[model samples]
Target: MSYSYTIQQHVYSFPDLKSVLAKASPFRTGDALSGLAAESNMERVAAQFVLSEIALKDFLNEAFIPYEEDEVTRLIMDTHDNVAFQEISGFTVGGLRNWLLSHEVDSQKLAKIAKALTPEMVAAVSKLMRNQDLISVAQKCEVITQFRNTIGKKGHLSVRLQPNHPTDDLRGVAASIVDGLLYGSGDAVIGINPVTDSVDIVGDQLKMMDEIRQRFDIPTQICVLCHLTTSLELLDKSPVDLVFQSIGGTEKTNASFGINLSMLQEAYEGTLQLNRGTLGNNLMYFETGQGSSLSANAHWGVDQQTCETRAYAVARHFNPLLVNSVVGFIGPEYLYDGKQITRAGLEDHFCGKLMGLPMGMDVCYTNHAEADQDDMDNLLTLLGVAGCNFIMGVPGSDDVMLNYQSTSFHDALYVRKVLNKKPAPEFETWLHNMGILDDTGNRLTIEPSHRLLKNL
Candidate 1:
């Protein structure tokens, strides 16, 4: 069946739902590079108009990657809540949008319908939303997850203390961690992206961070951002607080990264057996980004943002402790500039939170991209208001190992201070105990001669 609407005698037709979704998406170079973007701005408007008329259940019947060929699609179909979907069974995409934005809809109401909604449905609705609309609705939906520390509670924010080093230098990485901790970062987790994916290096890094965490008795977790296979190999021999992997939107895309649904489940279960978390057991950490499918030639003709939404389904299935989009890290090919990157960041956070994942963001960009610190400041501030679970806290806002610009220790402090958001509950207590945070837990009071330096 064809979908179309008319404007001033000009009939805009979409051959299929996929085409309609592709054209309706926000302007991004990756979609255009894939030849999936709207031909013109008017066509995009027409597509959005047609999409608004699409019924919510229409997405249930259509599979972008077909149920048989894609495991992600199959998981979506198998896990859908028919009973819960009945609540919105009669809604059009536009009607769902209106209902979502209404004053009556709050965090609890959205949570009830979250599992009933598919990623495509959420993604489709997201395209119809403005930047502020995304933020407003996301601000109302609270999806919290935890491991050793509570995160995603209202009025709280967390930072992944990313102390990445070019050579995986123990002392160098340790110094960065100290900086992050003193700055009241690392309430989320102290995650490191090693120069190599070597299991030995990953294990050693895990041990090093764990030792630091133990000496201070910090209430946060630590992870080495390596392949799930590497994590599994070293899980027992090393202190693996979290299992880390790079996931994507499609079966082929994930396969290109050497992961499948079963492998992910195995990694989840394997990490759970260690039982390392203090306050909770949520301990899988997965990272995703737009353009990953396009980069791997596995997007299957879908727009990059929609494909990104599908990756959220994977993260949601495992009940992950941390699910962050390395949004701008994929570079300008997928998200062309600060404008596009900012849009994608808001959209990812909105869609992920709606799909019931504890969403965070790596508010970052590459040096080659047409973005700078100012753009990041805008995105960070917006995400902070949107109640994003966490953001990356790299030293000096630059990753020596990954060689990209990201949020830093100071950035976290600025957002938290201006927005009146505090760190995770457990971490805030630790900071107060260490005298890094004042009695109110709103301001930091770092001491140069703190005992933490002696250990370092």
Candidate 2:
């Protein structure tokens, strides 16, 4: 249905739910580049106003992408928790926003209603939220997942030790891994985005990391960010803790990445059979970002942010251990500059957490983008305050292979110290035992002769 609202006799109209959502989104380069953003500030405000009055349940009745046309839509519709929705069944999107911000809705209330929320519903409500509103509400919701260690626990934050290398050199990759670990990072996982997708190379990397884990008896997992098929091919030969994939919101977008839901399901089931997890069996790591659908020409006119939330639905279905939004890495074409990038980062984190996925942020930007280290520091601190599950711990905030600037090992230390956060429980204990961190868990002890160094 077409939606319109009048302000001082000027009527602003949107042609459909999808159109309204696109127009209502906070100004970003992606929507504007796609010609889906509102034409004027007043029009944008009007769309947000109209969306607020739209009933929350109206989203349930309308599918942005027809269920028959999209499996993500079918997955959202067919598996939605109708029973849990009863709590807020009759509310409008604006009402849900107000209720979410009220004292009546605590962590438990958010968790209870989490499964009832659809990507569209969350995306619509997110449009009405300020950056602070996104952070505040997200801070109240908790989504914990476990593999070798638990993530997303309250009062604790985690970091994915992204020890990436330009070449698939075991010694070089292992060096970054050791550096990250020494700084009390990598509690989430020691993940490396390999230079190649070769199954043999990735298999060798996994074996090397696993050997390090075994030698140090570390309470963490290891992952080589390769294609799902490559990961599956080497599962028998290597120690794979988490299956990695770069998934998008639309089936076509996923297909562009050489992936489908069934492939993801098979990988999930295949990883589970390995029985490698000591803590829990959450066995997947999926990365998503805004504009991916548009980048792949598969958004079908939906806004990038909404398309991004749909990716969360896919992640939620498998109960993945971590869902990271590599925000700002998509370049200035989608996000434009630091301001837009910060907003998208906060919005993605909020939407993913509300969908009950363990969410992390790769607070990063490319060299050509109109961004710098200060912008990243700001986003990183805000994410810390938002209780983001984890972030990338890259070496010196630069990826020689990927050619991007991300949060560094020192960045993790700063956020943790400034936010008064600790690492995962098991990892915190390991740090203390290794004398890398004090018993109070406040600062790194920097033991020069640390035993883990000998393993190198």
Whole-model Cα lDDT per candidate?
0.92, 0.92
Taking every candidate in turn, the Cα RMSD to the unseen true structure, in Å, is: 1.0, 1.0
Candidate 2 similarity to native, TM-score: 0.98
- What are the runs in model 2 whose C-alpha is more than 4 Å off? 442-448
User: Tens-digit lDDT track for model 1 on 1-456?
Assistant: 579889889999998898899999989999999999999999999999999999998998888998889999999999999999998999999999999999999999999999999999999999999999999999998988888999999999999999988898989999999988888999889998888999889888999999999999999999998999999999789999999889998999999999999999999998899999888899988899999999999998889999999999998899899899999998888898999999999999999999999999999999889999999999999999999999999989988888899999999989998999999988898999888888555555555678788847
Task: Give the clashing residue pairs of candidate 1, or none.
Answer: none
Worst 10 residues of 1 by lDDT: 439-448
lDDT of 1 at 83: 94
True-structure RMSD for candidate 1: 1.0
Clashing pairs in 2: none
TM-score per model over all chains: 0.98, 0.98
What is the clash count of model 1?
A: 0
Model 1, position 277: C-alpha lDDT score: 86
